[model samples]
Target: MRRLLVLLLALLVATPAAAQVRTGIDVLQQNGFAQLRAVAARHGGKLKLAVLANPISVNREGRRTIDVLRTEGQAAVPGMAVVKLFSGEHGINALTDDMDIDDKVDAASGLAITSLYGRTDAEKRPSAAQLAGLDAVVIDLQDAGVRYWTFQTLTKYFLQACAANGVEVIILDRPNPLGGLAVQGPVSTPGREDYTNAHSEPMRPGMTMGELATMFNAEDRIGAKLTVVRTTGWKRADWYDQTGLLWINPSPNLRSITQATAYAGTALLEGTNVNIKGPGEAPFLRFGAPWIKGTELAAYLNARGIAGVRFLPVTYVPANDKLYPFAGQRVQGVEVLLLDRDRIDAPALGVEAVAALWKLYGATFQIEKVDRLLRNRAVLDQIKAGVDPKRIAAGWQADLNRFKARRARYLLY
Candidate 1:
C-alpha cells in the first residue's frame, strides 16, 4: 500500500496542470455579461449591439462569441440584442482571400454582416448610418501581436468611428499570441500611416487588442467610452500556447503558433517579390521564388548566425497557381526553423533575410516594395546600400526605447 501510494504521488507530480488562462469572453460569460448589460441600461434599457469578430472569437468551450451573445447574452442580459456582425480584413468566415470584402449575411446567425474591409479607406469603418442605432460595439477579434496585421487597424478605426458617434466600445480581450513581452523592430514613421501601419508601434508591438484600444483611445484623443474586459490568469510573458487555448488560425496562412512566430519576420517578404506562402501546410514558415537557389540562400542565412533560428533548403511547386508566385513552376527557397522563440528577434531576422536576398538576387528582388510592411524607408535604404543588418537593427534602439516608455503607460498586463 505504501509503495502504491508513492507511485501515485510520483505520477501526479509528473503531470502538468490544465491551462488556467481565461479569455475576456469566458469572464464575461461567467459574470452573465453585466458589463454589457450596464451599457445597455444607460441607453434606455435597449441595446442594439454590433460585434466585430472572426472564427477565432470563441469562449473557452469553443462556442463562437456571436452565438453566445445572441443566445446566452440575450437571456442573461435583459434588453440586450446583437443587431449586426462586422467582418475585418478577412470576411466573417475568415476564409476569404480577397482584400476587398463585400457586405453579406451570415448564414449561420442570420445577421447582416458588414464588411469593414474594402478597397477604399472610407469603407473600413462603420458609417454614421450604421452607428446610428447601435448602443455598443463589442470587439472580440484575435490579433497576431504584430503591427502590420490589419485587425488592429480595424479595431482602431472602429474605436474612432464609435467615439465620433455616441456608441460605446467594449473590447473582449484575448492573448497576444506572441505574448506581451518583447517589443521589437522600428516604430512606424510619422506620415507613413496606412491601413497596415495604423499606429506608430514596432513591427511586433507585443500588445493585446484591449491594450491597443486603450492606447489608441488616449493617445489619439478619440475619447470613446471604452471598456476592456481583460483576460484572467494570463501573464505578460505567457505565449498563446502557454494559455492552453485552442489554436485557431487567426488568419488562414498563420496556421500554428510556430508559423505565427515566423510570420513576424517572413511576412515582411510578402511585400517584396518573394513568395512567403509556402510549399507546405505552413505559410510564412518558408519563402521561395523560382530564381532562388535554395542551398545557397540557406547557407547565406545560416552563416549570419542569427540567434534562435536556422535555415533549411527547400524546393516546391506552389499548389495554387493564382495565389502564389511561380505556382506551377518549381521554386527554391529557405525554410525558417525557429530554435528558440524567446531569444529570436524576428524583425532583425527579417532585415537579415531581405539583405541576403538583395545581395544574391538584387536584379530581380523587388526590395523597394518591402517598405509596405516594414514601415521603415531608412532600413530599406540601408539594406539596399549593403549596410550590416545587425548594425541597422541596433540603430533603432533609441526609437524603440522611447516607444517602450510610451507603451508602458498603456499596458494592462
Candidate 2:
C-alpha cells in the first residue's frame, strides 16, 4: 500500500495543468460571458475574471462590455465571481504622471483596482490562488499600433505568467491606428530589450501592438495559447479615421488624431535633446532640442519637398512650468503641415529630418548619438555614408517584405 501511494503521488505531480482556454474578438464583442459562464458552470468551481489595465479611453468606452461580462458571471455562473481589476503605467483609476487623472473607483462596481506598474511592471500573472476558482483569464486592452507602448508589454507579461501557471489568456484585439500592413524599421536587436521597447526594432515599424505581439510570440517561441480578437473590416493600410470607430484618448499626451499622426516620428525627439513642447501653445505640438538651429533645419526640410509636409520656425516657452528654463528663448522651427496626410511616413520623415541636418552641418550635427535613440544604427549610418534617402529607404524593402509574409499568418482582421 505504501509503494502504491508513492507511485500515485508521483503521477499526480507529473500531470500537466489543463490546456489554455482561448477566445477571439467576435466572442468578446458578441457574447464573451456566455462562454465564460458555460466554462464556470461546467467546472462547478470558483471562476475569477480580471480586466487588465488599459488607456483611459479604452477603459471608459470598453467598460460597458466588461460590465456585461461581470453581470453575466454573477447571474449565471455558480461559484463564479469577478475580482480585482489590474492597470498598467497610468494605474487603474486613470492616474497618470504629470498629467492629472481622476482615480475614482466605480461606486457601483466595487471592483478593487490595483496598479501593475506600481506593484510590478514585468510581472503579469496573479497568484495561482487568484486563478484558483478560475478556469481562464480574459484580456481586453486597446493598442495604438506602434512599438514602445506599455499596453502591449503588459499583455506579453500576462501571457508569459499565464503559461507558467497553466492559465489561458484571451486577447480582445483592436484596430491598429496606423494599419495592418507596411512593417517599417529594423527588427530590435537582442540587447536593446527594455520596458518601453520590448522588441529591438527600428523606429515606427508601422505595426499594431496586436500584430507585434503575434510576431514576438512566434520569434521568441513563448509557447502560450494566444488568440487575437481582431477588428472587423480593417484593411492593412487603412488608418483609424477611415474605420469610423470611436475615438478616445489612449494617453493624456495623445489628445487628438493629429497628435497621434505626428507622434510616431516626433516622439523619438523626446529620447533626444528635443523638448517637443509646442511653441507657446496649450498642447504644444512638439519641441526639439534648443540647440538645434530650428530655422536652418526647417529651410533644409522645406527644400527637400518630402511629400506632404511643411515645417514652421517659432520660439516656444512652456506654460506654467519651468521645463525649459529658457522661456521666451527665441528658437526657429516650423509647424509641420501634412500636405498629403496619406503620404506621410513618420519614421522615414524623422530619419530624413535628422539626415538633412547632418548634411548641412556635418560637425555641428550629432548623428551617432541620435542613432541610439532610433534604436538602430542603420538609418543614421546610411545617411552619414551619403546613401541617398530614397535608396536607403529601398534597402529596407526586402526585410519588410519578409516580415509581411511571416505576419500574414497571424492576421486576425
Candidate 3:
C-alpha cells in the first residue's frame, strides 16, 4: 500500500502543466474573475474595480470579456459596488462598424461609459475626479503591435494616471499578433515623443504589451504599480495563428492579419495624400489611391527585390482622404506579399515606397510624409537628398540592436 501511494504521487508529479493551454478570455476569466473574488474575500470581501477599454471596431469578443468580468465582479462584491465601464475611443456595447464616434451609456452593460481618446498627450493624465472611489483599475485590451495603433498610447496614459492616483493596475495581456521575434521598423528618436509615435522606436523592441507594461514601469519610468497576467503557451516565435485566439478587430479598418502586417509599412502613406479607404469592402489592406503608377512601382520594387516580400501591380480607388474625386479611375499600386515575415523590415519598406514614389512621381510625391510616420526627420532628409534607400535602412540597425538588447530584459514569456 505504501509503495502504491508513492507511485500515485509520482504519476501526479510527472504530469506536465496541462500542455500549456491557450483559452483566450477563458484564461483571463479564470484569473481576473476568480482572483478578484479571492481578493474580495480577503479584503473584507468588498472591492470596487474599474474596467478600462479601447474602442476599436474589430473586437466584439471583448464585449464578452467585459461582460463576464462585470457579472463575476458584481457577484464577488455584491450591492455595495458595481463594475463601471470606461471607454477610450468608442463607447461600450457599440458595433465594430462604428469609427471613433462615442455613444451614450451601454444599454446591455448598463454602465456609464466615458471616452479617453479625446485627451491630449499633454493632458494624458486622467482627472483626479475620475480616479476617486476606485479600488483598482483593470485594463484588458488587444493590441496590433504597431506604434500608430493608438491603443498603446492610451495604455500609457492610464498607467501614468494610475501611478499618480495610487491605484493598482492589473493588465490582462494578449498576444502581439505580429509575434515577438523581431522589432522591424524605425526607432522613434528623442525629440519625436508624441502620442501617435510614443515608443522610442517606430517598431517596438520585440516585446508584447505585458512586456511593454513592465518596461514602462521599470525602464520607461511610468512608476505605476502594474501587474500583468501573461498568456501561457505563447513564445517569441508564436504569432496569432499559434495561439488559436480569434482575430478580434481592434478597429474598423483592420480586418485581417495581412492588413495588420501591411499596416506597419503602408500606414506611412496616411501622412501623404493617399486614400486608405475603399468602396464595397473594408479598406484595411485592399485599397490605395489613384495617384500611384502600379506597373512602374511594381517593377521598381521587384528590381529592388525587397527581402521577404513580393509586390504585384494593382489599382484601388478610395472615396475618402484623397485629393482626387472617386472617378472610375484605375489606381496603380502593388499588393504586398510577405514571403518571409521574419525578414520583413517595415521602416525599410516605407523608405522603398517613398523612394519609388519619388522616382515615379518626382516632386509630386510627398517626401516629408515618411519622416512624420517614422517620427525621424533624418530619414526624410536622407531620402530627399538622394541617399540610397537600402543604405539609409542600414543606418537604423545599430539603434534597433541596442533597443532589442534592452527589450529582452522585460520579456516575461
Candidate 4:
C-alpha cells in the first residue's frame, strides 16, 4: 500500500493539470442567466428573444446554448423565452456547404431558423420584419480568428440591423481558437469591404467575437443596446487547445486546431485560382493546382526556412468538380506541417507561398484574384512586381501597430 501510494503520487506529479477555461455560455449558466433575466425585466416582465447559433454554440458540458436558453433560461428566469433561431454561413447545424440556406423549422426545438447567409448580399442581414417584436437577439458563435471566415461578418451585419431596428444584442463570447495574439496580415483597404472583408482589420486581428463586437459597436457608431457575456478563465495568450474545452469544428472544413491556425495563412490562397485542398482531404493543410510542380514549389518554400512550418511535395486527384476546377485530374502541391504554433508567422508564410506560386506559375496562377482575401492592393501590387515577400510583410507593421493600439481598448479577457 505504501509503494502504491508513492507511485500514484509520482504519476500525479508528472502529469500537468488541465487548464480550466469557461466560455461566455458557461459563465452565463453559472450565474443562472442573471444577465439575460435583467434584459427580460427591462422589457416589462417578459422577453421574446432570437438566438443566433451553430453546433459550436454550447456550454462547457456540451449542451447547446439554444436548448439551455429555452429550458434553463426560462426556468431560472421567468418570462424569458427563445422564440426564434438564426444560422450563419454553415446553416444552424453547421453542415450545409451551399451558398444560400433557406429558412426551416428545427425538428427538436420547433423554432423557425432564419439563415443570415443567403443567395445575395442584401439577404445577409435580418429584415425589419424579422426583428420587429424581438426584445433581444442572443448571439453565440465560434470564430476562427481570421478575417475571411464570414461569422464575424455576419455578426457585424446583425449588429447593424439590430441597431437600426431598435433591438438589443447580446453576444455569448468564445475564445479565438487561434488565441488572442499574433495579429497578422494587412487591414482591409478603404472602399473594399465586403462579406469576406467586413471591416478594416487584419487577416488575423487576434480579438475574440465579443471584443470585436464591442469594437464594432463603438468604432462603427452603431448605438445598439449591446451586452457581451464575457468569457471567464481564458487568458489573452492561451490557444483553444489549452482551454480544457472540447474541440468542435467551427466550420465544415476546419477539422482541427492546427487547421484553424494554418487557415490564417493558407486561406489567402482561396481567392486565387488554386486548390487549397481536395474533397475529403484536410482543408488548408495543402495547396495545389493541375499546373503546379509540387517538388519545385515545395523546394522554394522550404529554402526560405519559414517559421513554425515545413513543406512537403504532394500529388492529389480531387474527386469533386463542384469546388475545384482540377477535378478528375492529377494535381501537385505542398503540404504545410505546423511545427511550432507559438513561433509561426502564418500570414508571412502565406505571403511566401503566394510569391512562390507567382514566381513559378505566374501565367497559370490568377494572382490578381488574391486581392479579394489579401485586401491590400499594395501587397498585391508588390507580389505582381516580384518584390520580396519579406519586404511586403514588413510594410504591414505600421498599420498593425495602429490597429493593436486601437484594439487594446476593446479586449475583455
Candidate 5:
C-alpha cells in the first residue's frame, strides 16, 4: 500500500494542473484560428451579448454583419453572455478628437459604453464580476508589434482576469504589421510593468498574437484557458501586405504599411517636442519641428544612408489632428522614404533619429519620454552618451538570443 501511494504521488507531481480541461485547445493546431470554420463549430449556434474590448470600428469586415455592443463581430463568434469593453485615455474606440488637442476628455462617447476606463486610464482590467459565467471572450485587434501600444498589455490583463474567473479567451490572431522578424529593443526591466509594457519582450517584438498567447501562457504563467485562432497560410516572414489582408489603420496615424514599419523606430519620438507628423497625412513617414530646417535635416539623414530608407525634405501643418501640439502651425522636417523592408534596421534608425534630435534640439527636446517607450532608461542613457546604434543594438543580443530560443516552441509560423 505504501509503495503504491509513493508511485501515485510521483505521477501527480509530474502532470500539470487542469490538463484534462485543455484537451480541446489543439482542435485547430495546424490551421490558424483566423479560419472561421472551427470557431463556428462551437460558438455558431448562439447569439447573445459579448463582453469585448476595443470596438466594432476596428474590424471592417465584421461590420458587414452583426451589430451588438459595438463589437464588429462575425457570425461564428460566441454570443457574449455579458458584454464588456475598455477605452483607455487614447480613446481606442474612435478617431482622434478634433477639438481635444490635450486629450482632456474621452471624445469617443460615440461608441456604445460597456465599461469605460477613460479618466481612470491607468487601471484597465475586467473584474471577476464582469467575466464570470461567460463561455469565452473573443479578441481580434491589430498590433504594431511595439510594447507601448496598449493592446498587448490589455491582452495580458484580460488574460489574468479570465484565468482567475475560469473564463476562456479566444484570440483571433492577426499578423504583426511589422512582420514576424526583427524582435528589437530592450526587455521591460524588473519594475515598470503596466498595461503598456505588459511583457518582457523588447519594445518591438515581431510575434503575432497567436505566438504571444503561447508565451503568455508559459512565461507569465497566467494559465488562462486561451485558444488562438491563427491566420491560415501566414508565413513567419510575411508582412501585412504579404498576407493579402487589407491595411486597416490600426490607429488613426498608422495609415500605411510603410508608416507602420517606420513606427518601429519613430514611435519613441512621440515623447518629444518634435512632431513626427503622425496626425497629419503621413504619420511616422515624416517628422518635424518649428526649429528644424527641412533641407538640413533631410541632408543629414540622407548622409547617414541608413539601410532600406531614404530621406526627403518636406513641410506641413499638423492642424488636421487637433491632438497635435503643433496643430495649425507649419513645421519643417524630413520624410522617411522606405527603400527596402527587409534591410531596414528600424530601431537602429530610431536611435539615430533620437541622437540627431537631441543634438539639434538640446533642452527643447523632451528626451525623458523616450524612456517610457523603450521601457529601459539605459537605452536612452547610452544613446545620449553618443553610443553607436549598432553597438547599442548589439547590447541586447544575449537577451534577444535567450528570448528567441525560449520563444521557438511558441511560434506557429
Candidate 6:
C-alpha cells in the first residue's frame, strides 16, 4: 500500500497545469489550474497564509484565489489573511473591473489590503508585525508582460519584504498578457531601477511573473526562498488572447488584450506631456495631444509602414473625470490601429513614432524622458543625434537575443 501510494503521488506531481474551461474560468488546465488545486489538496492541513493579491488574481474557472481558499475550509491554508494591494495612482477600485468612470477607490474587492498604498489611511509597506507568522505568500496578480506595468514592480517589492521577513513566496503563474516571445528595447540601467524599471531586463521581458521571479531571484540574488507554481500548455509565441482565459484589466487603463499588446511601446510616453491614455476606453491603443497635428503625424507614421499597425489623425480629451490626465482638454494626435496584430512590433513602433514626432515638433515632442522607462540613456542620445528609429531598434537586437538566451533557462510554460 505504501509503494502504491508513492507511485500515485509521483503521477500527481508530474501532472501539468493543463487548463480547460470545464467551468466559467480557464483554471482547468493540466499544468496550470490543476497544479494550484493539487497544492491546496496537499496543504489541506497546512496553516498560516497570506495572499498578495489584486483584483485579477483568479483561476481559469473564474474563481478568485481568496474565494477558493475560503471555500476550502481548513484544508486550503487555514486562517489565510488577505493582504491589501498598493497601486500608486490607481485606486483600489481600479484594481478590478467596473463601469464607473470615477477612478477613485471604487472597483471594490471583498478581500481588502490593510496596508494598501493607494489609500491615505494605508501604510507604505506592511509592517513586519503584519507578516510575522505567515508561512507563505501566494502572488497571483495579472501582468501586462510589459516592463512599465506596476504589478511586477509590486511583486518585486513584496518579494524583498517577504525575504526580509523570512517568509516563502509561491507565484501562481499567469500568462504574460503579451505572450512570452518578444523582448524589446533595452535592459534597465542602475539608477533607473525603481518602480518603472525594477529589473535589468528589457522593456518587454517576454516572461510570466513566475518566470520573472526565477530570474529576479537569481540575478538579483535576493535570497528569498521562491517557488513558482508554473504554467503548462502555454507557448512562447502565444498572446493572452490565445490563452483560452478571460482577460481581466489589471488596471483601469489596460482594459483588453489588444491594449496590453500595444502597451509595451505606447506606455513609454507616460513620463512625457503626451497623453497615451486617450480619446476613449482603449488606452495606449491610441494617443494624442492638443498641440499635435494628427493628420500630418499620421501621414508621417503611416509612411514608415511599421509592420502590423496603421496610424490615423485623432483628437481626444482624457475623458475619465477622476483618473483622467488631460481632463477637459482636447488633444490632436494619431490613433494607432493594428492591421495585423501578429505583425505589430510595439517597441519599434513606439520608437519610430517618437522619432518622427521629435523631428516635426522638436522639443514639443517630449521624447527626452524615455530613458526612465527603457533605461538605456543611449536611446535618447541616438534620438538626439537624428538617428533613424529603425537603426535605434536594430541596436538592441543583439542585447535582446542575449537576454532571450539567458531567460530561456527560467521559462516554465
- Could you tell me the lDDT of residue 210 within candidate 1? 94
Q: Single out the weakest 10-residue window by summed lDDT for candidate 3.
A: 54-63
Across 1-413, the per-residue lDDT of candidate 1 in tens digits comes to 99999999999999866459989999999998989888988998889899999999999899999999999999988898999999987688787667778889988889999888888888886899888789999999998989999998898888888999999999999989999999999788878888998888899998999999998899889999999999998888888888989998776688889998988887888856677884344688888898999999999999999999999999877766466676677789988999999999999998899999999999999988888899888888889999999999999999999999999999998
The model with the greatest lDDT is 1
TM-score of each: 0.95, 0.78, 0.84, 0.96, 0.78, 0.82
Worst 10 residues of 2 by lDDT: 17-26
Residue-wise lDDT of candidate 4 within 41-84, one digit each (tens)? 89998899999999999998999999999898999988888999
Candidate 2 lDDT for residue 350:
67
Give the per-residue lDDT of model 6 (tens digit) for 1-413: 99999999999999644343222123333334343344445545344556666567677666666565455423433434444333332433354322222322313444435433533322434557767766666677777788777667767776777889977777777777787776777666656676667687788888888888888788888888787766666777777776677776678778888887778888777667777774354688777777789899999998987999888788767775544456678888887897887777888887887788788888676677766676788887888789988888888888788888888898776
Instruction: Give candidate 6's error at residue 90 in angstroms.
Output: 3.3
Residue lDDT tens for model 2, 1-413: 99999999999999754322222334443554455655555455566666664543242234444565566546666666667566666655433433222234655578765456643432433555544444556676656656666676677777766767766565666666766565665554557766656665545566655666787777778876665555455666677766556666666566666777676666555534445553234232445445667787788788877766888766555443444433555444456776675777776776676677567666655567565546666666788898877677778767666666766775665
- Candidate 1 C-alpha RMSD relative to the actual structure: 2.3
Which regions of candidate 6 fall more than 4 Å away from where they truly are?
1-46, 76-92, 95-112, 115-124, 320-325
Q: Which stretches in model 4 have alpha-carbon errors above 4 Å?
A: 1-16
Per-model root-mean-square deviation over C-alphas: 2.3, 15.8, 7.6, 2.2, 14.1, 9.5
Q: Which candidate number would show the highest TM-score if scored against the true structure?
A: 4
How are the candidates ranked when ordered by TM-score, highest leading? 4, 1, 3, 6, 5, 2
lDDT of 3 by residue, 1-413 (tens): 99999999999998643223343345655554665655455446676777776543122244465666666646644532545667654344323333344535767667776655554543444666877877677777777778766667777777878888876777777778788786876678875666676667555455667777787677668788776866777777776755656666666567777777777777777656555444443343433456677777788888998888888778765544333334356565677777877778765776787777777776676667656667877777787777888988888888878888888788887
Per-residue lDDT, model 5, residue 372, is: 72
Which 10-residue span in candidate 1 carries the lowest summed lDDT? 273-282
lDDT of 5 by residue, 1-413 (tens): 99999999999998544211110112222233233344335555442333343332233233311143233233234443324344433454545533232322224323233442433443466676666545566666667777777777777777888788766777766667777877876676757786568787777778877678778888888998777765665566777766555556666777778888888888878757878754536878888888888898788777877889988998888755545658778989888888998998787788878877777666677888787777777778887887776788789778878777877889876
Clashing residue pairs in candidate 4 are: none
Model 6 residue 193 CA deviation (Å) reads: 0.6
Which sections of candidate 5 miss by over 4 Å? Answer: 1-93, 97-112, 115-117, 121-123, 320-322
